[model samples]
Target: MTQKDAPTGADATIPGKLPATGHQGRQEPAAMTSTPTTTRTSTRAPLAAHGTGRVPPRSGAVLAGLCAAVLALSGCGGQKGGSPAAGSVPDGWGTLATSGVSVSYPKAGSGSGGYTVQTAGERSKYNAAAAERTEHGVTVSLITIQLGFTRADTAEDAAIAAEAGIQLGSTIRSTRKVKLAGTGDARRIDFEFGSTGEDRTPPKGTRIEGVILTGLDSKDRTFAVRVDARKGTLPDADLKRIVDSIEVH
Candidate 1:
């Protein structure tokens, strides 16, 4: 669907189902690096496959480490004079429930909607923590979040709320239709921009976008839903890598 086809306003209804043919399963190398702490536990590990299902490590450690790194970087820069007070530290990534739908937060980062809105500088500092790579002619840095819902709840409400900062028009335009692991289900959702043109240092091509997915468990409880976004438009190939990288079981 085109941008004009979408409803106007920031609070628009997200379209129901996306076309199934637009996305492809992509295989890419997963590279993990971890720094030693005072303890013996290593922080990073490739999520393991359990009985044909993808189950990632608890998102708590990864998110806490990333937040700590950002706070440290912000302190080092000492640029708080004009910058807004850093917003609430996000909750640890885990299962979140609201109404009927439930979702598991994907690994790689915290919950999608709870990000600390950073100034251009702050956003830049966080982006720098991840290894940089270019895909789809649009520069992209890999990112992830977990989405979850509780028993007896549907994930629809949470999914809608997560679209808050997203610009519906631009989002529809950039979403690449995709399917994961031969599941007949397809996914699509727009990216979100944290700052406008001049405020952003990345070239004009960079548009913050969100990737969304939905599913239901055996009991009919909606399960781990997800939306991922980064600073710019990502090549479909790169976008698939980020989406496929997510693990939930």
Candidate 2:
């Protein structure tokens, strides 16, 4: 009875109480000690914030500014209203004065009258004055005057000179005698041939009508005036006016 029942409650309590104290200080809850949970962060930008489906404001303004600059530069040059300057010749007519001759031409616009004066000298074979006026869509009128110092003193001589001077390279159709009021007796030579191969102004194979006037001036000079036109372009009255206006001084 001594060993089996000697103080059983005290010994059991001592062994169990030591075990409870040791475990209480060392053990912890699983949620509290899970590697101290580091918060995760993202390194990528959102698609909606960067890839919006529209042109940027800064780029749109730049394009508009470029267009405005181009339009402003285009309006800087060129004549305003498409009209000629002041003190200029009127439309539908032109005047030219040269080589002691002056004439006004019809249907000849400003700066369209062509005049050339050649003097007689050793190097130059002859002295001549030529003028041409062309109505762009209608016809061409040309006048050539040759000064005859030793030859072409008479009307017949002037006619011969004119026949020799004409180099149209086309066939002659007819010749007749005509009287010019201001000038002396004159001869009219007509041609009904196309322009020569060398001439490119008129259409090829087009039958042009030419009227030439050969007259003797008071100073014994020979003047040959040629007026060529597309058929029916120049009226007889207009031709008469142009012929009558010729004056040599």
Candidate 3:
């Protein structure tokens, strides 16, 4: 075959020869000739190629979730704090008049004469009440209200009771219980002793008149009002009226 009719990459010419241009004859070139050539190479790639270091998309979402959880936990452990103001007493409670002094009681009752309650100290301060009445000639009107709670509401209830006691008198007494009546408001009551004559000391045969009246309000707050006076000085009928008048709304 001649070189002009040969296919690419196929060995077509003999060394140092060319076909001659003559009838039924060919002449070869003086020097051998060669054609231009090309070469190719290929590289394969992997399915998952890595880039410069970076956080995954889900990492940001996880971090946000963790931050939210920490905030919620901190909020749950917080506490409440404050102080009570005068005359800002809790609802369903009121003060009774007794001469120059006053006492705390339910608003329902009415009393005549000097059988009154005083919230001021020195006017009527509360001293300790022991197993029995002594030279003080005093008696305590005690009342206790029990409540049921699913958790520790004890501190809050105690604070409320203490505030009420302070407003009632300097010699006021108070306590708390976890179990209570249908309303679930726990409570306790104490008394104020009166001094006889001008000496401000316990008087001989000065019997103490004691009574406690209680009722519950819609807000689950218990109302316990107490009255302590001189037996003869405060009429039995009037004292009964005061006790019976306590009405809880």
lDDT of 2 by residue, 87-186 (tens): 1233454443334223334543333343222122210122133334344432233333334322444444444333332322333443444444344345
lDDT of each: 0.26, 0.32, 0.23
Candidate 1 least-lDDT 10 residues: 44-53
Better of 2 and 3 by TM-score: 2
Q: Which candidate is the best by lDDT?
A: 2
Consecutive 10-residue window with the lowest summed lDDT within model 3: 15-24
- Segments of candidate 2 deviating more than 4 angstroms: 1-104, 107-141, 197-200
Q: How would you encode candidate 3's per-residue C-alpha lDDT over 1-249 as one tens digit per residue?
A: 111121111111110000100000011223322111211111111000000011112244544552232110000001122121112223454544222112233332332222122222312112111011112333222111111111123323322322222211122222222111122222222223222222222343333333332224334433333344444544445444333332323
In what order do the candidates fall by lDDT, top score first?
2, 1, 3
Clashes of 2: 0
Model 1's lDDT to the true fold?
Answer: 0.26
Off by over 4 Å in 3: 1-112, 115-201
Identify the leading candidate in terms of TM-score. Answer: 2
Report the C-alpha displacement of residue 109, candidate 2, in angstroms.
4.1
lDDT of 2: 0.32
